[model samples]
Target: MSVENKKLPQSYYVPAQSPWPIVGAIALFFIAVGSGLTIMQLNNSNVSGVFLLVIGLAILFVMLFSWFKDVITESNNGLYSTQMDVSFKQAMLWFIFSEVMFFLVFFGALFYTRNLSVPWLGGASNNVMTQQILWPDFQSFWPLLKTPAGDTTQAMGWQGLPLINTLILITSSVTLHIAENAMKVNNRRKLQTFIGLTVVLGGCFLTLQVQEYIHAYTELGLTLQSGVYGNTFYLLTGFHGLHVTLGLILLVIVYARILRGHFNDQQHFALQAGSWYWHFVDVVWLCLFFLVYVF
Candidate 1:
């Protein structure tokens, strides 16, 4: 009953050994090294590190493209099996778990800043000059507005662009659900429509996010260098944006495979993985909207 049971003598489905994954690992190594050196050089006045970082990132992208192309080709050739499906599902689940841990680091930083760092700065402990030296008028609140460095910024409320983006992302998750359900029922037209709509909605959410960033940086004068608040804000939200971009790319690939008559009703691991990623992104955005913007 399995796809592999219908195959030929060999039990190998996509038995090809890919060199690109190893190349990608190498590329990431260079990128990490280059980035570390670049940051060090910024303070030490050394310029060589940035060059390495750029080269590493370039190689990494190339490796990723080549590797993804190979997988796509193998998948289209009907070389995947139920075992492959389980593997993909496990991979995606672990991937999302890793992402959750990544965000937890930022959330930990936020908690430290709010509950400890800011309080210490305000002379909560035995240090009297802490208040005299810095943040004399600082009030410690959950959604930080006045930074310890005396840089003031208006906290982004949840009612405007943030709310709209939240709704858009939630709607996208729903549309992706519809697409997955359509795939289950073997409705290619409905699948394509829902998937395409979800992609468009994702694009719109990203565009709005860009606009919000522009407003924050330019209009509101709240930049990454503003203070600790800006640093955490940008780090969390910017990384989320990058994930959304990757999720959209995955959705596009699934849509392309659908059009090529791939991913039958009984076996569509690619679509399922992409849907999981999209939903993960959406849930992260929801947390960000409440914690970062609304508090």
Candidate 2:
């Protein structure tokens, strides 16, 4: 936008043309292509997907940094009025709402399969004829490990890594809150320490999640192709993990800004935004722990 001071505005702030939007769009394209290729790599030994995925992620990281830097620069330049703050907050809320809807679709699928489809296939209600004509020996059970073609795979247990990761996420949420409070009080040392702790906890959660995936594939016979159960489980947990990764990056950048004294207690919207996102991630994980894992 205009490189002017944050002065009184007679109207709402209208930003000047920015290339960041196009740059972000390009990053998203690379990510989509890379993700499709990586999924294809499960069957074929194509390493190009991994290469593309890394490049896409790198570009995405840079794009986010540059875009945020521009906005923060504008804010510091006093170009943002109260109206701009409200707009920022409204946009963030809408973005989070969109994320909620995205996950709701997946969760709805899980509910449909577990509560309806499985039983229908097992001869529940009017599906008696379906069972007899399909597989008379079919048993309706959670996980549905045995495919119709007789491919047998084991179900993942909720007891080990899943439980540990849940606890880690909850703890990280607490630490983030503490850091937020510390920032509000201008306790830089406390804020930095707790933020560091939260980031470490996030890293640990990701590492353990990777280990869990490895265990699932190596020992539990679980994979994306396992069945409906596997599909829901991986899709839910995998997307949540990706969100956590993004939040971790957000916190890292916020930490850097904090160290540079870019925010005061009264005007730390960036920190607030990051904290809001991380808390949302934590809540999503709690849902997954119960609905996707334990339940």
Candidate 3:
């Protein structure tokens, strides 16, 4: 190794205090409050909630762009040492782990409601009296499409758009893997092509998902107000859709980085992180496909 290379610090690079965190928190606060108010005002004529939601999202995008710009500048300037790279890797790992736990909570709720709570309400085990007195007409079902409150929604099937979206996401994962391998071999042309294809696949998946939501609401009468079935269905799938949107954004950023000649075969932590996240999103979709649709 060259002497200059050996001179690279073993300590991590800690950037000076930044306002991005606070800005991000403020953006999220607005998003949460605005979303709540917007949903509440859905039947009303007021548009203030929608305004705030847009402003919040705009601020969030600005914050993300500025933050990533700073990171990219530092990275290209070689401010990040080996230790810093390890720290970044660890941070990405933990972030993905936290996301897994976050989704697990919602999945756990679905499982509990399906296996225990609904069954109990429908007279399973020793709850015969409960069912007879409270919900005599309610039948325990995996989907619980017809709630005790009489609200009904058509169940989303696994075929058609859902299956197509599944194939798109799975294929995107494969493309991303190919992109990563191309990056490893320093084949920038193949890397850019594969990653660009992955981005297109992601966009297709999102388009299909939106179409599916429209079909659910317009054709099947499945909506957020359709009781437990609709609630769990939308919540789980909605959050996953948001994740896919974020993943698409990340992949786009990575694609831009590739175009700018940012990453090479040796040091491409940003690409690696983005690819890791994309893979995680793909895995989560597989789980959702099976649990929410098939099972």
Candidate 4:
């Protein structure tokens, strides 16, 4: 074969060892410890736990900023190849799968508590003697607003703010899809407009969620201390809210990249990943609405 006709072996780019992973791990450790302490100190009027939490979050944010900056620079420099793109896509898929399992555990807990545990406690399946001895007045209901311990809380209904938030999320997902379509057609104006709308919708959803929480705590007498119902409600919805916040951050980053002429129709894995995550968040909210609010 002629020298000019010889095929060159493809080279894979390997990034140098970096400190960001360790820094991120340390930040997570601080966040976990700080959050635990904060929860423990809820009634003690201690501010140290809050201080730690803030520090941890600040460090985390810095780590993310630096990490993403490095990634963007590398991409802009044409460092990534087709293999790297495939690797990123696979990583994002696995990440989303892990998130699905993470939520499945909580949903499983909700199901078990509702279908089996509560029923057993209420004298189902020949446990009459058990119920009689344990608590004769305890009732087995779906919401279980009135706990066996005599703590009562109103259940959050699906008619008002939650419904509105659900619609907003669904609409945001649609808007993001439209943005993706616009990206495919190389219509920067349409892409930016749709994504901007999606971001606004996300912000509105979060605002309404905060208002809903305020209503629950102040007006509805619902709180973490209310009982198992309250515990499940807050944990599920609160975690979902955190996911929504993360999705919003990702969308904002994608929007900034779009403004900077970062992505093209054929190579926009970051935008695709962000869209997948946003869709996942929307689906989770739908489940939460049906399970927690409606039935």
Candidate 4 residue 98 C-alpha distance from true site, Å: 0.3
lDDT of 3 by residue, 1-295 (tens): 8887686547678899999999999998888889888877877899889988998998899998999999999988888888898899999999999999999999999999999999999899999999999888888887877755676778999999999999999899999999999999999999999999999999999999999999999999898778888989989999999889888888899899899888889999888999999999889999999999999
Let me know the TM-score candidate 4 reaches against the reference structure: 0.96
Q: Is candidate 1 or candidate 3 better by TM-score?
A: 3
- Candidate-wise lDDT, in order: 0.83, 0.89, 0.91, 0.92
Write down the TM-score of every candidate: 0.83, 0.92, 0.95, 0.96
State the lDDT at 110 in candidate 2.
92
- Among the numbered candidates, top TM-score falls to 4
Best by lDDT: 4
RMSD of 3: 2.6
By TM-score, highest first, what's the ranking? 4, 3, 2, 1
| Residue-by-residue lDDT tens digits, candidate 1, 1-295 | 9987795653447565778878988888887899778755755667789888889888977886777788878877878776777777898899999999998888888878878887887678865587777756766555566655566786666788889999999999999999999999999999999999999999998999999999897777677666777778888888899899889988988888888888888888889889999999999998888878877
Answer with 2 or 3, whichever has the higher TM-score.
Answer: 3
| lDDT winner between candidates 1 and 4 | 4
Segments in model 2 whose C-alpha atoms lie over 4 Å from true places: 1-12
Off by over 4 Å in 4: 1-9
Worst 10 residues of 4 by lDDT: 7-16
Extract clashing residue pairs from model 2.
6-78, 6-79
Model 3 is weakest, by summed lDDT over 10 consecutive residues, at 4-13
Among all windows of ten consecutive residues in candidate 2, which has the lowest summed lDDT? 1-10
**Per the 3 Å backbone cut-off, how many clashing residue pairs does candidate 4 have?**
0
Q: What is the lDDT of candidate 2?
A: 0.89
